[model samples]
Target: MGGAPERADGCGARVRGRSAGSGRLSVTARTRGWRDRAAAELAAAALATREETVGDVLVVGDRTGVLARALGDRGAAVHRWGRRLGEGEVVSAWPPDGTVVLSAVRLPRSRAELAFAVHAAAARTRPGGTIAVYGANDEGIRSADRALAAVAENVTTLRVGGHCRVVAGRRSEAHADGGPDVFAIDFELSADDWGSQRLRGCGGRYRTWPGVFGGAGLDAGTRALVRVMAGFDRSPERVLDFGCGWGPLARAARALWPDARVEALDVDALAVRAVAANAPGVEARLGDRVEGAACYDLIVANPPYHDGKEEDTRVIEALFSDGAGALREGGCMVLVVQRRLPVPRLAAARFRRARPLADEGIYRVWELVGPL
Candidate 1:
């Protein structure tokens, strides 16, 4: 209806064809189910009219397996950025002009995440272009509507259906500041301060404010893993900090093995940025997987086990699988987790060997490795 037309695919599902310019469209989704629902809705809208022209479509956020499955019915170029997109993270650079940008994001629980969502929504929409956001009732959909209205030129709650509400807005001017408190802050980490830093179990203190992992204090799982890590031969030339939160493990690893080059990867862009700020010397990248062919001698992670508000293990599985593939022969993946999680079972199937290295009463360090 917005000048875009939908065309029918051979699979009988309606798919939107490309539009003018780059003909690229962007859909930011929350979970796998939501992604499927949104894609179906968009596909239906696109096929009924067959007028919307889109060359490429990019879906950003978690449970991309669902996004891939939903897009499977359509014959179009599709790419995905996996779980937990941070502030200002855009899956594609497709301009908002004459584009259909759909966001199925949950309400932000923290002020930092809220600011990030606002900025992300604004960046995806062009002047006078429409952006749609859908969320469940309890996720503060109403509050989200209010917040969007305050920032955008025209905002409206388009629909509320299936226990979910859709809010649409258009930005005619620059985004009003989400307020100074939510703005990014500068973080400095130094050896001088490291001596006093108290990050989880690391006796040396590290400075990290809110929004960073283990920001409030150290989690029990990380503290347990750090203690057991000392028992392993720590002299590896290459190491990977999968799901490195706030650079605590990176900081500890770097201190123990000064000669090793450590690579930190996290799904949260904000976390990645924060880690970089706190550990300038440590190589950190924002992404879902371990990038590059250089296998690490050691891979450590406390992979995320939650999605939005529910307990989900998809992200953790992805990291564990990737870590196994990214480790060199005889290299080890040291992971810490609550004993209740079936991580050992998951690891046993994925790794050549998996066993508990140490149990700290609450958490256990699961070590998986190639033929030891």
Candidate 2:
């Protein structure tokens, strides 16, 4: 961590190296503090326990590229899988034969997500190669050994510190068949739930993997939002589905406004791929932020409220602010959320006016007009 600041490492994570001719230090930029704890612990554990040089490595769920940069500095060729495009390669499915010498995973929030990551790592690692998983104890690092045991052997604790733990296991030669595909769950959305006359025959099939919100089916909030869209008097020429999960809003928007150009944006790579598969013809972009001010005619969203297992309002707030900025002068943004959240207040903070559209007891829809 001690060195002059260097240029960004293409993945948006900053890298620090020695000045001029001096040799580089092992520490990379500590941009994400506590969020990088598990990654730091895994890097330390891997570097210490391995008898030989760290060879080809695969890092998963290291959102900030903490482990990837650290391992790369130690002479390991690192490959990273992440949610956003700039973070790493956003692959829907890892190649079956892309085996590596070592793989490090930062445990995800959902158990299904954790299982998918661990199984993928194990399958892609060479027989007897190392698979290391780490996370905070409260975030379910305690179950790392059990999850790895399904696809690996000789599971053991590697390191424990800073309320985080790293567990390692040898990739079992028997599980070379590869892990579950990214599109692991398939479900159909009924036209009746949409409540739109235009969408009566547009019922479509959708595929989703673990971790994406509303993966099981169309959630009640999104359904309510779509219903509200059906009643709009004006047909928007351009539509943006911000935080589009599986592209339900984008699909409905396309069906309702046939001539409108529809776009979908999401941070998750799997979610972006699902949108492409489920809502064909729409532009699905893998990004963490909304681009272009005053570019969209209509924006629809069901912004996420959680940063993991913990409920955080910053996600929704940022979406509101950005969506407002992305709308045209005559455009509006529609949103749905749990009634308990402060949607009206959040909208008022960014838009000139906030109008209530529908309230289904548990979920409420709002229309925000004219960015301030």
Candidate 3:
């Protein structure tokens, strides 16, 4: 478990990891459940493709292993890029132009995210080169095609299997990116004694691009958590925003305690960029988990619950599991979660002490004290 782990063809082999293009085969986590089904469908569609010549393949999004393998089997050099970057992909500093980009787009995401995919793919594609997006019908693949049409031409259905479909389009010469501004979206948030409301107007003051949790605006639960966090008497010296969305909590912490060293981390690239651009002083990191988050006075979190359509608490559990080791003797981990979530109970199981600081509307803020 060093460098980066890659999921092999099957069998869920994850202990040993291999470098990207060493021609070395790595054991990949077995694709099961919905993921397995989606990959099979997408791979089939990519295989059936003969309408356009594919020289290079660039894949984005989840279910990448099977699809990457399938495209590679078709004799195209495959490069995997997206949120899931480390899983046996020829990682790149930036995507190459004139290449075919395949994306496994999830069904639920902001319009801005879809637009970014369309624009990004087009920017890297040469004229007559194709870009294909695959997802379940529930994921709004057809609607996404409409957005794709904005950046590419000849947009049409490539294939359909089960409840999933693949949409492909060729980037035309007419499309030339003036700038990255076309991907920007406005987030307007209002204050109600809850944090700063994050975004105040549609002037595009916020640095959000796409696909970030709570980047659209402040979540009600997060706002509630912030309100209670502000009421606390002690001023923390060092703060960590675990799963920080747009650096709202981290920014608020910095404003509250100017001397405090606030840091923000997220799994999304857009979020990391947003925080770095919008929140001046905080350290921004793009990563999947908190590994060496040590000796922080306060760790704030509003962890995500779903990976696309699958609902799970694995991430929340990890945050709590790591809390016991990451904090100082008298430090705190403050989590804002929906009323129905079992975060309080989860915290209690890990820390032996969990305090319900505030409960407002559908959100509750829990303060879990770390052990000495």
* C-alpha RMSD by candidate, in order: 9.2, 6.3, 6.1
Query: Could you give candidate 1's per-residue lDDT for residues 1-372 as a string of tens digits?
Result: 112333332211112222112442211123235533543354333232221113233333323333333443455333333224321223221223223333333345554554455555555444554444445565566667666664465677766665556665666576543422354554444443333233323443344433556664457777677666655655888887877867777767776677898778664555666566656577876455453333788888887776556677876776665567667777888988878889767776568888888787778788888632
Q: Which ten residues in a row have the lowest lDDT in candidate 3?
A: 9-18
Worst 10 residues of 2 by lDDT: 11-20
Clash count for each candidate, listed in order shown: 21, 0, 7
Candidate 2: global Cα-lDDT?
0.71
* Angstrom error at residue 187, model 1: 7.6
Q: Residue by residue across 1-372, what tens digits does model 3's lDDT show? A: 013344331210112233245552321222224744574466456553653325665665534366766666677666555542333333222233444534333333556677776666666666777767766777676677888788778888867777777777777788775444555555644444344443222123456666667756777887787777677788888888877777778767776777998878675556776787667898876544454445678888888766556666777887787666677768888888877887767776668578788887888788888653
lDDT of 3 at 180: 47
Which number leads on lDDT? Answer: 2
What's the distance in Å from true for residue 58, model 2? 1.4
Residue ranges of candidate 1 with Cα displaced over 4 Å: 1-31, 34-111, 123-131, 170-182, 185-217, 230-233, 291-294, 350-352
RMSD of candidate 1 to true structure, Å: 9.2
lDDT value, residue 216 of candidate 1: 40
Q: Pick the candidate with the highest TM-score.
A: 2
lDDT-better candidate, 1 vs 2: 2
TM-score of 1: 0.65
Q: If scored against the real structure, what TM-score would every candidate get? A: 0.65, 0.83, 0.82
